[model samples]
Target: MTGMSRCPAHTERAQTSLPALGIALVLLTVVTGLGVSMADAAIAGAERTPDERRVAAAIADRLVSADGPLAARSNVLNRSRVDDFDQSALERSAPPATEYAVSVEVADTEIASSGAVHSGTQITRLVVVEARESRTLTPDLTTTDTVTLPRRSAQATVTIDPPAGTTIWTVRANDRVVLHNRSGLDGSYEVPLIPYETTELRFQRAGSIQPGNVTVSYDAPRSTKESLVVTVDA
Candidate 1:
């Protein structure tokens, strides 16, 4: 009878232990599922960084391209347009897929920007800014028969100060007749330079004024290096 009682007690203990084992297995499964989910999230977050970086780089490239909104030529920005840039223009120029921000700097001066910048992938691109430059040209006719422009010019202000008796007749640029006055010429004349080639201005039939003075003013397209930063947030 004592042995029979012990067997029944053992069975009861086994049944109680089975529930505990089942509970422990359920807890283990829950913990494992949580760990897998956390790992997947981490991996997804890591992959997003490269995507943001690529997007930022592509946007920057487009901004500095020849056909880009801010560019006058390939990788060259128009200084006047850049100065006029605002957030609205920037957004219109660069439409981001996700949240993003952009800032442009020329010669260490922050020129334009868009959106709010925070922690994000950034891309830096080299850009050139075309700034208008002015210079004065003085012709030394006494030294030489022809005066050659140092650089390509689009316009000039010609002032003829001839001697008492002599009068200017014609002006030729690179053998092409730009100005022709059969009677006589004096005073200031605005001349347009040839677009295709370099201009060599030659004065014909000037009086005692051995050295004639001509002022050629033009827009000189100058370029400088700048940094364009584009940042994208995911």
Candidate 2:
């Protein structure tokens, strides 16, 4: 060749050492893995910041709506009668049920450094919330309630003092009802229950108080002569 071209063998070796398709595949795998990892992290981080607060606010607003299902539940405000309190309904009605209580804390978190272009310029403020899951069922039942109302009051008055910033309040009755105060989301209201039976109550919220319902799902009385039966399956 005119310029003393390199040997064909040398050229082949260099090409084999760094094949174009191989390099491209390696880069694609790295980029894809990074993308998936970032998406996962974003979802996980959403539970603790502005995203969490936004979700909480939306839930609170929805709970206040009359059309929202949070107001009606077997153990909650299902003011009407049903064979069994619908656990499925409660679950479907309010997603991300933060158990016994949901506590919201607003704060600011500093962003130490910005490594690349198009990044935010200042420290970001964050909303932190701690949801206190209901522990009533895990190890024991700890709810204490006492009822004293007229036999036929068209409206029953119950004052509930839930944690502050509560969006939804769910109530379950032992009996009947005449009217329910469609109150705001402040955790206090007068509710009318049916005549002559004890009621079990649970309060929950996604964004606002779940609608109330009347039900005959009072707990059954236990007889003194009843014995417990235990069976073990092999």
Candidate 3:
């Protein structure tokens, strides 16, 4: 009787208390882990700023290297003129997620003989550079001549029945006068010049707003009303 003296209710209470204590300890461990994680993240953020800047500078340096000694004068890089090599390097070192504006110019060079100070002022080559997350693909352009004029008049409709949304079509006669430019989106361009010499009708793909290829064909003026065919593929 003495050995089994514990009350049944007391045993039940003891068992419940143990489980409660265990649950409390588990919650405390989880909270401690979360606090430690947050502290580590804060420290990492503090450390990353300078490192990112340094990497950005290095990217700029590499970009300048391509132009040789003239690159030393350059302080910026434009994203538009980026060649394949520059593009690859930029992707590796500084990802597009980071925004950057780089201004590049060739430094001044001594004229050597007269010692004329050619200050590396920003020249026509001034490039506006920007880093972005997305890129617009260049459309594939193919040119085929429908007719080569022995003598082309500077003024004349070089395009026959042209595809829809065609522009920048140029026809030069005698190699000087600007005959026609359908550069605008819609409407007809009037050319007052008479056809002289072998006229060269050039239908160039002015480019498309979306990603696609544009095919433009030059049709003889005598062919049909709707003669020109310019195809655009994105």
Candidate 4:
């Protein structure tokens, strides 16, 4: 027998190894991409400090409180106070703001800030801004003994300048006696009224009362909802 050509088993083994090597390379590439992504997220998280967020939240909370400098009531900001808000006002209202770079804004307008803040943690609150305006009303008491106020007021200045023969002794507001005199009632008097109810001023007198005899001046608060934002950078 002349030299017979034999099939080599090593050649078959080499062909099988090629497929396994390709699969291993694909798995390595996938693992490397996941590692890179995790590392980037970790780096970004490390850059943000917890103090900034805490301070921002605290400032926003204090600003909307009832006792705050800019608030007339809880979550209601006074228009005059908001206009006067500044760095000193912020520090006075929120002491934590003094230590950090804090910025306060309302309706996208910067109202107060302790420091220049480009970017940082932020806290937002929905609030109402109130503006009070003084208005006077002198209703005709001849047609009816009751006079209803158009707007709600916390307090009012009641002026009783009755003409001769009109002996006014008592004044009732919303069925509640606000002013009473045994002999006679005259001059301007400050009366406290509830802001939630519509007030009807009633006069108890023996004679006819003319218009402009009783003048009531009260503050009418107008409110509009707005957004307040506080940013802190450490």
Indicate which candidate wins on TM-score. 4
Judging by lDDT, tell me the better candidate of 2 and 3: 3
List model 1 lDDT by residue over 118-200, tens digit each.
66777788877777777666767765656676444577777776667877789888878877898777778888886446778
**Model 3 lDDT per residue over 19-90, tens place:** 899999999999999999999988876575455445434544544445522221243332333322332343
Q: Tell me the spans in candidate 3 whose CA falls farther than 4 Å from its real position.
A: 1-11, 57-81, 87-234
Can you write out model 4's per-residue Cα lDDT over 1-234, one digit (the tens) per residue?
233333356677889999999999999999999999999877775676577887888889899999988898899999999999999889988998878889999989999888789788889999999999998988788888877775558899999998998888998997789999978899999988888788888888878888998888999888899999999987
> Which candidate number has the best lDDT?
4
Q: List the lowest-lDDT window of 10 residues for candidate 1.
A: 207-216
> Alpha carbon lDDT of residue 41, candidate 4?
75
**What overall lDDT goes with each candidate model?**
0.73, 0.35, 0.38, 0.87
TM-scores of the candidates are: 0.67, 0.21, 0.28, 0.79
Residue 129 of model 4, lDDT score: 96
Per-residue lDDT of 1-234 in model 2, one digit per residue for the tens? 945566877888888878877889999999999999999988766544454445445444443244644223111212221123243543344453323122211122111111122221111122112121111111111233223333322344444433445443344454333223345334335555553444434433333221232112122221111111111110
Q: Model 2: which ten-residue window has the lowest total lDDT?
A: 225-234
Model 2 stretches with alpha carbons more than 4 Å out = 1-10, 20-49, 52-234
